[model samples]
Target: MLPSTDALLDGLLDWVRIETHTPDTAGLNSIMDLVQSQAEGFGATCQRFPGRDGKGDHLLVLSPWGDHAQKGVLLLSHLDTVHPRGTIEHDLPIRIEEDRCFGPGICDMKGGAFNGLAAMRAIAESGVTPPLPARILFTSDEEVGSPTSRSLIEDQGKHAKYALVTEPARNGGHVVTARKGVGRFTLKVEGRPSHAGARHWQGRSAVTELAHQIIALEAMTDYDREITVNVGEITGGTGTNVVPQFAQAEIDLRVPTAEAADEMVARITGLTPKTPDTKLTITGGMNRPPFEQSDASKALFDHASTLAAEIGFELVGEKTGGGSDGNFIADRIPTLDGLGPDGDDVHTLNEHIFVSSLKPRMLLLKRLMETLS
Candidate 1:
């Protein structure tokens, strides 16, 4: 059964109203407190892990009655929003008009967190046990790729039988079964400097050499294999009259599979510049590994889609170039993500969540959790 659509909407409204940007430590803590209080009221046991700054914390809520030694499913969410603390000054005070709910972080994730709590709350109120012993992990820093909470996510994920991440879906209403790998690399070059007007060949132009490497990298992109190498940022040169002594560039690559990732890494690391006059230094590696689909994950998706079909919506899946917390967990265990409300224009003022989808997705989550046992 699905959660009451009206109740889910009201809960999401309260959630987005809190300015819980992880960077804003105070705001993050306050939001965590609000959630902690709510979970406690549901009789869920909760614990907080504070960060280095003593500001933000990761909240873990467990089934009220469970054996500590046994591992079970872990549901993941984050208490932080991507917007700044003051974003509420403008697009805040969430408004629900027709089929959409507009606000900061409404669709990206906060809505998903609400669904997790609702499912557990429904069970708790009914005095019924969940499908299994469960763990709800609410992290603090997901927008920036879980810099601090990543190890903890993997640690808990390894113990659980399965993991569910609540990142929003690409299409308006669906879930993710796989995601491409993401990598960040820097290509730097050093050359001799001289007066361009007086001595042309006396200096090796680092900028010129960097241009060759950039072109070479771009040439490696193969659409057939779904590989993309993007030269996102470049900086070099001192003056028009002087040969540039140093040049640097940032590279972003997205690949579909581990084999593709390995192939790309080797090719990128061994890039030989056309101009040997400049010394090339490339430093960077895969930050997030690919969340390739596995047979187990596919079965889980089938189960979820079956549940969705039983409800009312046709279920489908898609592959995304974007990376999420799911990528990190997928490396060790079967994971499914992109399970939040539908929306677009995240990280901008125009961000909005489909008001109509919120309740349905919550219902989806509720039904799925019940089946997990």
Candidate 2:
């Protein structure tokens, strides 16, 4: 049975009501229950692998028509979101204003995930056996860089012939073909502390050293290769009257290719402390390699575009600086992303999905999955 618009929206609302922030193991498991229940209803077998670092277990649902022994299509998505608890009740209370449905994670993910479920449902109801095995992997961590789920994703990518990611469709209905690689880094500086008034010259300020590092890091951004280095967060200092002895900075880096990523990391780590007495420590590296578009990936995109055209819409692929779990899988298999319903303002209280876009997106996904061999 094709899902009615009401049913899809109802499912999206039901899933969105649960706040499965990245670190909330219980919350991620709870949302997985909802997802697994639907998958099971379609005759898919489910397995749960325990997560590390206090995250929820990763859930895998295999269609009865497919098996791990054979290569097939992999549906990739994350169950966790960026919004914390109380977002639904206090911040964006679930509401529909004309064509837009406003709620946390609705656009960023939950909506696209619901499309996955709906597509599988339609295929199962049609009773058409897929030519190859199909698998659905629901990870508990994606927003936090998939630290725990990286290996699992890579393993699955190795077995799958293709990967379809449910990250939100880019604005203007563009699908993602390439994404910049992501890296997380921390910079710390240690210096001698002294009373600001009593011996200002006697103290080397760590904060001052960190400030210089931030400038140097920002200067590393190269638009030519789409390399961007941002010091997203920083902390230091003890009191107004004391020269700070320690300071730290958290950086976010994105590069267009793996070679550029390596070069960028090498340069960042090679930085020298300006103050002679200050000691600097740097940690963390690339999280996901860039999703470079290859001929195989382009072929997959072309197929999806053809399928999209059948649904009466022209699909165009674009490169994005934002990274997804697709960044991990794309390098391994033919991956096509941004297969979710169109939406905007993700990671914010105003996040929402276009209510009108849900049905067509689901249909498109259903067709693509059905066409997979």
Candidate 3:
């Protein structure tokens, strides 16, 4: 049997209390230490990868029941959150109101990560060996696009038969089977600066050129094609009386398929300046490839849905625009995402998970670990 709802909430609170912001190496390592200790206490062998580029360390814990060399089940989770350190003190405090356990990272991911650990611990305690070796990877840089941990995740993917991501369950306890590819880019415009009043004809306005480009970029969005281009941020100009010499805009792109991703990339990169005497420079590309649904993934979800029904809950698959580390390995492995606790208002001041949903989700994960062949 899984832990009681209150017991599960207590464990999750322990994790939510520790703020593991994406870039805070110290705080991240602190949480990693807790995870390592817990996994070690449960007789799981662990390997720690020291973080580089000022990111937090990563932990890989393997179940003691199976051979370490064989391809097995990979449980993917991340410890870092989008909220900063002081978020708990001011923005979202740890509190239980009705059935919701409110905290900074509880809903976004920490709850799901803790549930994965709890399920593993229960299985270990029950003394029933899983059919396949269970490996849980706790990564540190997922919210910032997994920049430091992508290679590590992919390396493990090559050796795994199935990948399960503990990202937050979507819209009322739905699992994710497909995700759009994500792209981030910066566009810069350069032009001659001159006093607006004295030599208006001699100077080119980079801000004006950037504004035109922004309009064109926004116009590229096609809802029917499932492609979106957002000029999220822009900065330019020094003074009102002078023509701007430099301007830059940060863009975000999403595509539902590899073909769409390639087409959008070419379109965005092929931009030219409409303004005379201005230079346009673009940098950056697709950060994550599209996780299109496949036969293997569909079969995996069908198994999960069957298991969920047996466990007395309805399970469905969803395709989200947001991407996760599951996007990294979905094409290569049978991956199921959004296996975390059900919650609402993730990555906001109101972030929280439903206390009632804890035990059922834990049981679902435990069953998946034990029964997946």
RMSD per prediction, one decimal?
2.1, 1.2, 0.8
lDDT of each: 0.82, 0.89, 0.93
lDDT of 1 by residue, 1-373 (tens): 4457787888877878888776788888878888899999979899888875433788988866556456677788987888887787765656766877778888778888888888777766766566567778888888776888888888888667777877776676768888999888999999999999999789999999999999999998999989999999999999999999999999999999999999999999998767767798999888789999888888778888988888788778888998887888786676778877778777777778887777667667767766775
Worst 10 residues of 3 by lDDT: 61-70
Question: Model 2, 186: alpha-carbon shift in Å?
Answer: 0.4
- Residue pairs in collision within model 2: 66-133
- Candidate 2 lDDT over 1-373, as tens digits, reads 7888888999889998888989888888888888888889878889888888898889988877755699988989887989888878888899999998999889889888888877877787789877877888889988888889989999988889999999999986789999999989999999999999999999999999999999999999988868999999999999989999999999999999999999999998888999879999999899888999989999999999999899888898999999999998787698899999999999988999988888888988888778877
Model 2 lDDT-worst window of ten = 59-68
Superposing every Cα of model 2 onto the true structure, what RMSD results? 1.2
Among all candidates shown, the one with the greatest TM-score: 3
Q: Is candidate 1 or candidate 3 better by lDDT?
A: 3
Which candidate number would show the highest lDDT if scored against the true structure? 3
Prediction 2 TM-score vs. true: 0.97
Ranking by lDDT: 3, 2, 1
Q: lDDT of candidate 2 vs native?
A: 0.89
- Regions of candidate 2 where Cα sits further than 4 Å from its true position: none
Give the poorly placed runs of model 1, Cα more than 4 Å off: 1-3, 53-55, 91-93
